[model samples]
Target: MSTSNGMRPETPETPDHESWWSRIGTLGQALTALTGLIVTVVPILVATGLPGQDSGNSNFSPTVVPTTSQPYTSPPSTTPPPQAEGINLTVSDQLTDGAEEEVIVITLEGSRVATLHATREQPVVSQRVTATRAGNYSYVVDAVMRWYDETGTEQVTNATGRGSVSIDDGTRLDVYVHEETDGISLSLESATQ
Candidate 1:
């Protein structure tokens, strides 16, 4: 059909392309202008808040609290005490009735020797020795043949079997035995330094 201006009638299959462009022309330009304004004004606002923006407020109140009362207190010192020169030894045994035994040994180096014994759920033996010189030295611990008698008496049967003391310096010592034994013989078992 023809219109008043003599243009042919538009149908669904023949859409008016000019009508689409005309609708978006002003809207697109306005959007572009709005985006430019936002970009420019936002950056200026951010810049105004940045450091050294103006010296008028350079001497503003300190952001940190000024201590009119408690000045900053220093933390307590964390220095360790000076260590002495000597060797200390500790031996712990994990003794289970018929099960496995685990031992722990610890040694500390120094100049004087000391012996200590402990009996907890398990038995423990220890020694500490002080070195005469500043050089390397070694110490020994002989595992004497021992057993708990049928009558529950603890007895040392042989003094020949030996187990070396694991040293932690000239002074510290620790030795551990992990094994299950009935006390018939002194087994090397497992010794850990």
Candidate 2:
């Protein structure tokens, strides 16, 4: 008489195969380590101040872009051949000195009538445009400057001023623009200043 055994006899492990229990244990350990790493690194990333994280009450100021257009148009004169009409306008840039990266665009619309491109070092005067009518023409001068700030964002600033110039024969309408800490300032050559 012999005792009955339900299980089969054990055999040698396969040459290139891992044990199933051992593989499962290793995978579980690796998953746990990955979870631990994420837990450790996430706090560091947040605390060290990653970009695009807003606290809801941010003081960042939005950029300001300036636009220019001539709203007032004078009618062409029906004067005789002996009479001609037009205003001579000139723009002088007196901003900061030698700012190579700064791009300054000056737009003259209305009376003076010329768009001038200038920089800190170079000032430009536009060609004289013949006036269609003879009167005190009101014009708008807009100086827009663009530059790259330290944060790698393109920063734009604008200076604007309105002037009225009277022209009959050869009116040398001159305007000056300057950059100040508060903003831009403009002056007319005929101004009392």
Give the count of colliding residue pairs in each prediction: 25, 3
Q: What residue runs in model 2 are displaced by over 4 Å at the alpha carbon?
A: 1-112, 120-122, 147-155, 178-182, 190-193
Error of 2 at 96 (Å): 4.6
For candidate 1, lDDT tens digit of each residue in 1-193? 7999999987657456667556779888789889999998888777567565663556678455549688766669898987766543333333324322223222223222333333344454543344433443343323333446677777553211234333344333333333336433222222332
- Tell me the whole-model lDDT of each prediction, alpha carbons only: 0.44, 0.57
Give per-model TM-scores.
0.26, 0.39
Model 1 quality (TM-score)? 0.26
Best by lDDT: 2
> Residue 178 error for model 1, in Å?
9.6
Q: After superposition, how far is residue 115 of candidate 1 from its true place, in Å?
A: 3.2
